[model samples]
Target chain A: MPPKMNIEPEPGDQTPEVGAATDVAPLGRDHGKPAHELTAEEDADGTDWGRVAGESEFKGLLASKRRFIVPATIFFVAYYFALPVLVGYAPGLMDTRVLGVNLAYLFALSQFFMAWAVAALYVRAAGGWDETARRIIERLHSSRKEK
Target chain B: MSTPLLMFLIFVGITLVITYWAARRSTGSSAYFAAGRSIKGWQNGVAVAGDYMSAASFLGIAGIIAFQGYDGFMYSVGWLVAYLTVLLVVAEPLRNAGKYTMADVLAYRLSPRPVRAMASLSTLTVSTFYMIAQMVGAGALVSLLLKDSGVTYQAAVVGVGILMIVYVVFGGMLATTWVQIVKAILLMAGTILLSVLVLAHFGFSFGNFFDAIKHVTYHAAAGKVVTQDFLQPGLRYKPPYGALDLISLGMALLFGTAGLPHILVRFYTVPDAKTARTSVVWAMAIIGVFYILTTFLGFGAATIVGRDVISKNGGTNMSAPLLAQAMGGDIFFGFISAIAFATILAVVAGLTISASTSFAHDFWTNVIHRGTERAPGEEVKVARVTAFVVGGVAILIAIVLGPTANVAFLVALAFAVAASANLPVIVLSLFWRRFNTRGAVAGLGTGLLASIVLILLSPSIMTVDPPTVTGAARHLIQSPPLFPLENPGLLSIPLGFLGAFLGTLTGREPSAEARYTELVVRANTGLGAEKATTH
Candidate 1:
């Protein structure tokens, strides 16, 4: 074995989703080789991926992502920026007393919480998204191998 | 000379050692551009944070708050929220799709030549403007720190220019990444120390700190007395267009960060999409802590250092260092000043490599060589020459423009170009299959032109304050601005998106549309993405 940098994840574990493409591992690893040495087999058998793009699962991935992202972006942009907009237009409401600090400071502090929550939520949701991408790649590889 | 200059030499020495170490690893184009995609997630996370926080964020935001009060905190809130856009949308897709430059993604489904040419133009323009701002800011800062120590501003400008160029020429991306990592560590430590000192001064009570911020008073430009109630807004925003100006500036920062060519290219340094995702989280966490502490630093300057002295010594940019001097005398001041100097140097080096890489990889080889990259090691040679030229021009411009040039406007312009020009194409080409070569060209051209023209006509350029007007502002029409708003993001971003949609409807490139399926699968799954080359 080459004394690889420990920066890499455990060899096959990183590719567990594409586990079906194990037969094509040698061809894919040829990316480190010179450009001309990259044979057509890298695109022929388990490597050709055009069929995977057209699958319904792929379209569903896009749709589901849009479903999460569209609302999240709208909510965060509106909620976070509302502090500045309201503080500009309606100063009295923001200046209303709470603790030693004013209402404006409280609202500003909440934005940090909202950002952390949203980022954590997305990372959690993306696990499922990654699984779907793996299944699509695996299915394409298995079909190509049978051929 | 003094402790600050001595400290600066030590900083240069450390980076030189790192550059010598990196020079061997950076022989091939892949290593030079993407560090062979070998950087670990956490180290890259620190480097990315370093790239994002300029001296402007560290010194500039605190100074703005010290002078302007609660309205200055708005920048912190807006800047932090902006990262969500990067994390939620841009990070993973960009890492998987791009190899060296953002042009890789933009030209993936388009005609490589014209698409790359336009992408390269936008990249050079944004990075050049940003580099000049950093150079000029360094000159201004050096003059303030070395008042009677006999170092001229021109010498300061040349020294910074030479140091940054040497790092790129000798070290390339690997050296740049490590410099950024070290700088980030130093900045975070300095900020934490300053915050702790400020809290101690207030009896370690949060209430006392807040009370002091509410009570500090400053002399307004018009000779009126302004008491800073640090929690209430509008010390800077005074009615009418104040709300509009706030929104426009907010929109630019929120969208601009994701589109920055330097920032976007950093994603390619890591090995996989998962690493890219984690990097964003780590960067935001560190960046958020720094921004939040600005409130303490700014308030400490206002109440402790006194507004009159800060403004008299070096304007708003000197508040943080002045606060350090007030807190711990001259030694702390020297340490803080050296970090400020290193901050500017690291950021400019990052900008230089990104701009040079786009020129060679995107335009010179892809456009001129017809994507062959024909001769071995040719791209690396072209990139080195371009880095030297870019650094030289920035030095000449900084020298001629002098120390006090009003170049802060250039930072806003750089952000505007990134958000308006570069961002629209990256988004559309990745998600919208019908987006064609014509649409990519149209989006880029419209965004670039719209941002430039609007900024020229806007209040920031037109309505310059009489006391500080110099260079082009002295000869320009000085009155009510043709465009009422200061930032043009609200108008230009929509125009970019509209141009893309209209161009796709008008121009038909069937081959470009046909390649969209492959681009989509490759970006989503990393099926045949470029792998890290062997050592």
Candidate 2:
């Protein structure tokens, strides 16, 4: 078995002995307590969540996430709405035959490819965010152990 | 039995067997509500696709395209593009923070009882509207397909409802997930085969296909034969209100998907936030490809089957099945009809579970009992009871409305409510530090009321139909519409955000500010997430 992690129970919360007993049980690793058994008030019992949120790493993570997500969202919403707007107001231009089909149909078809491209790009960017998140968690665990 | 009825029965039998196997494994609340968080990324992705597609995408959109030309294909685009909202904004944070339902996240940092109450109310409203449409559609399709066997619409509606309840109450989320996965696979195979046949009918050439589409000959409404360009826009959404309605509908679909209770709950069935993200990617790929192929399904029907024949055969919704009969004969028709039946059953099961989960977890356990299950396994019991009640109610309403009812508006209203009510509060709770319980309550209440009220005043309900339209098919109101747009998203979404902002300014809650730090940490880092069960 792997060595026990260094997470501490909150003062006046479950005893360490009780935690250990539940932790060794079969099935879920949530110390024998299912998610539905825990109230929302008790969700952050063991962690110093305020400190973690104030950390520079977390802020950097949020900033990078916003940087990728904000522009991507704007680009897609604008690109998608352009179809209905142009089709509604400028039917003549949209009706011009491009290759074999009309521009209206071609523009509508392009939306599927555009959505796929955006999703692929987001998936690529999210990989870096996942790595950053891993580092932040490792640091928090190590800090808890030192204390 | 006819070939189609035999094929449909086989599909139902297979799903019942899966439900029976899954019933044994679902012991606790987590297993029942979330499938024990053991679902893999790709599996959850396919299930999400299955839940999202519904009969609306598979049959309704195909019929629309076959009838309305370019305007009909817009629904396919909005539906697929909506996933980008799911992927970029909501999926990871939700998986990391919430437990079983969407209200779990709202209850995390805010006051539990008030927020959970409003959220549950909105969830139930949205689910009911969406479910009625599917149930009515199922009844209509089944009766049409099985007319030779003397099965009535009411019998088919009850059959679909009972099967949906059985899947939810007995087998729970595991069974629901597997049913969705099975349905998704069947739907994709059917779509791919039909698309290929459509291509083959055009001599395997894009030029030949477009040439036919350019000159579609059919009888117009006045019984005059006309040759028209099917690829051009403005066939269905025409003149004064059409432009604004299209834009409003676009906004609803783009934002509404991320807020859907059924779709959001699928994220919680995954092990972690990363897996959730991966699943969203898989869902996008599958949904995008399926929608793109609607180009073939819709246009192929218009060119090959002809609008005149489809109108006389089974109205608009039978375009896909009729095209199948024309292209690959009767056996293929049976196969496609069974796929459509499977599609409706899978979607209703997804909706029932999500609705009942929210009612039990958010409203009964949290709101009424102050966040405690009074008895062991009481929450699951309540959810099971709720599923039965929900399914029974849907069956009754669909039968009352009859087979020919216009329920396109109900699906549109579902999207509008989800976008306006659920999405705004979810975004604020995750991002804004000042957001409190009041803001969530206000957002949910205002968004819910605004969408419904606007829909009541909009063209969907108020327009006058010609004297030829009769019974359940006519509009609810005979007067001219007060609201021009059919969908309420253009105005209601902004009003929802405004309500939340105004409610936040009404009070200063220091505790909510303090807890925002905790919520941000858990939402981004998955620090205190529930672990996946090991077998």
Query: Using alpha carbons, what is the TM-score of model 2?
Result: 0.94
Interface RMSD (Å) of candidate 1: 2.8
Instruction: Please report the TM-score between candidate 1 and the true structure.
Output: 0.92
Candidate with top lDDT is 2
TM-score to true structure, per model: 0.92, 0.94
Cα lDDT tens digits for candidate 1, B15-114: 9899999997787888998888878888888999999889888889989888888888888888888889999878888888778999998788898999
Model 2 chain B, poorest ten-residue lDDT window? B526-535
Candidate 2 lDDT tens digits, A1-147? 799864545457643455555566432243433444543344446778878878898999999999999999999999999999999888889999899888999899899999999999999998998999889877866565566
DockQ list for all candidates: 0.38, 0.45
